[model samples]
Target chain A: MFEAEVLSGGFSNPAQDSARAFRACLDAMARPGRIQQIAGAVPPAPLSPAAGAILLTLADATTPIFIAKSHDTEAVRRWIAFHCSAPVVAASDADFAIGTWDALQPVSQFAIGTAEYPDRSATLIVECEDISAPTATLSGPGIETTQTAYLPNLDAFVANSAQFPLGFDCYFTAGNQLSALPRSTKVEAL
Target chain B: MTDQAYNFAYLDEATKRMIRRALLKGLAIPGYQVPFASREMPMPYGWGTGGVQVTAACLTPEDTLKVIDQGADDTTNAVSIRKFFERTAQVQTSETTAEATVIQTRHRIPEVALTEGQILVYQVPIPEPLRFLEPRESETRRMHALEEYGLMHVKLYEDIARHGAIATSYAYPVKVEGRYVMDPSPIPKFDNPKLGGNAAIQLFGAGREQRIYALPPYTDVVSLDFEDHPFDPSKADHACDLCGSEVSYLDEVITDDKGSRIFVCSDTSYCTTRQDEGHTGRLSPEGEAA
Candidate 1:
């Protein structure tokens, strides 16, 4: 064990902290475009607190994670290996992927899942420099009337909506703040 | 303080992780039933094991849990589940519908309107809307994938042909987000309208079926019906005899062997609150003896 690198950043109390983190994630996902704050992880550089916390809460041996080129570093891999035993795989085969908006390039590379099993699609954990303000309109399940959030790429999400019931779900993380955009959301330019 | 005899919420950390992942996928899918590794509970399968496990997964130490059975908080299933969490999870349990963060229900959503922050966990006996029509799981799965809900429409049409109306009073099926036709557990058709555009997240779990599904807040949930027939949310015409509340779902209760009966609000908590506010019906104090 790289005791200092691995053990220092994870949840201090696995049970309680993970529970709290999960609820935050659930609320964020259920109510797309709503920003939330998740605590209890101080992972190595390139991984935000919310992203690290999510990996601890959701990733396990069964999930194949993809670390995008921007955040792919020796320290990040070590932290991931120590905290989550998930196998790292290519973007297309990943159950979950982590990186900034651009680093996760050719977003089409990820699985959009099959018609028979749409839930099998990948969930991208996006690391953002800033995730504030609302720029585009979003209406769908979870959203009351219509919500507005600043998505890095509006056309990508609009295209994603066309694949409704099929596209990949995403979580945008900046520092400790998190927000989500599921496939069900109807994204539009404001 | 709570006893440390069991893990927090009575589930190991790994199990919670698996459930959490499934819940996220379910939310993302919106009314699509996601399969999970359902765990055994101390209670029987019918006794809300699904709802209990869901609550356990969703709960935090800060949450206030409430359990309801057929709209009443005092029923055996409700009491047992509430006590189980109170003992094992050491979380605060509330009887008031407004104060509860997580409400686990066997049947019947509370009469009170839920807000955005609240969550409702439904104990579902059958997670599949087409389970009865198509006995084969594989075919039903394919049908769901292909969005072929003709069988359900046919089933409803047959009901209209026989009973002059769609006779499904309970376990009403609803289409979520115009995508998936979902089973809203065993809630009466009267509560079907409330399922759509709700402020709270609705989670349905079937431990026996090993499935979990969800509807995010304000999701479109349309009860299956024909244009001419229309989905009706009818209830007993009588008001609650004790509380004088005519809007709530009523249960017909027999008074004695003389075949005397009276109607009361199925939601005991709501009825009590109404009564406390001095709302009274035909069976108020002076008129009760008659």
Candidate 2:
């Protein structure tokens, strides 16, 4: 399923690009409410560059991922399966879930994780049409101060954070840009 | 050299840097299992992935490596791990504990006392002692950060209330540096006492769980116990029939169809060394009473 073409002029290996993107993810997640743009592969459509970058970075045979709606295309599935060997699971049982906000179903469908093992909660990568600086207000663990990003919906996220460590961590992916909002972050409604 | 195909120690320099940073934090606060984004190795989980990751981070080309499972260097998993290092890092491997600069183990601590320059790494399936009690990392991290250990004490206290002794015979929980209550892996309780004030640096890695923690030499690690019920590190009453050593942990082995069983030291290397040195028990051909 993987259209294996050795891309020229980029890092010699996909693993190198993966490492770089993964570092961006680590920095983005560790400091909640941060935006980091990553570019490398132009995955087939419905798989945004940002989301594709993330899949390349963190997903492997070790991680289980769930694809919802259009993101569940066979082509995309085959690509991921061939490259990462990451098992696909139901939304309720995934370590990571990918799709647009609607495709993922009710935001509450994913595992929020229990109190003692919040890290068990699934991280969602929501593909968006566009992302810009002039967005909603955000505050959380990674925020040096307060940061804001254009969110699909602010109230749902604010409600999500109220659960405290039990909420799913989210990454908003659009084009080649991505930003993270861990459960520790507190979103404010404008 | 075959090692040129991969980076030093099989892990790239970037991954090593990441693991090294986490190890430093883990060492700064002994016994605290720091959460690290553990990477997928060329090997599978439930094997020696955790120990492999830790060893990958710490190994230098000059270091002599040792790998053991159930305390024997010849065990299949031990041989596999030793071969991994040999292929990836090109480091010298040893079966003797004293000759090793770094030792990775599962389920047994070496009987030979480790010194200051040596490093011990443990393969952990689950690093959280309270994971079965509470299944949320978020809650547990908060619990640790706040120094809340009531749940652990209550669990142990209840165990005593039911059983005449603490029911957990192995993998006993320990409070390190008066802070985090860490799982000491699945070593028999007899080795629990060796966890504290040790001259060698100890590190633990749980791959699937994505956590790494450490114990610096001389760190204070106290086993949990109430004043009324002191911690008991007990082993089987019988000594090894081959080694004649009563001070080591023993694995119960059933030798025949009639259900006759013999107790042998769980630490195979230590037992073999003792037997090689002419130490023998009643069952040995060269035993004093034989």
> What is the C-alpha local distance difference test score of each model?
0.92, 0.76
Q: Which segments of model 2 are wrong by more than 4 Å? A: A1-190, B1-3, B287-290
Q: Considering summed lDDT, which 10 consecutive residues are worst modelled in model 1 chain A?
A: A1-10
DockQ of each candidate relative to the true complex: 0.90, 0.03
C-alpha lDDT of residue A62 in model 2 = 63
C-alpha TM-score for every candidate: 0.97, 0.61
Clashes of each: 0, 10
Give residue B82's error in model 2 in angstroms. 0.3
Clashing pairs in 1: none
lDDT of 2 by residue, A4-119 (tens): 52122123345446545654564455445557878776666778878977776666666689999868887788777766678999888887899998888788888876644444
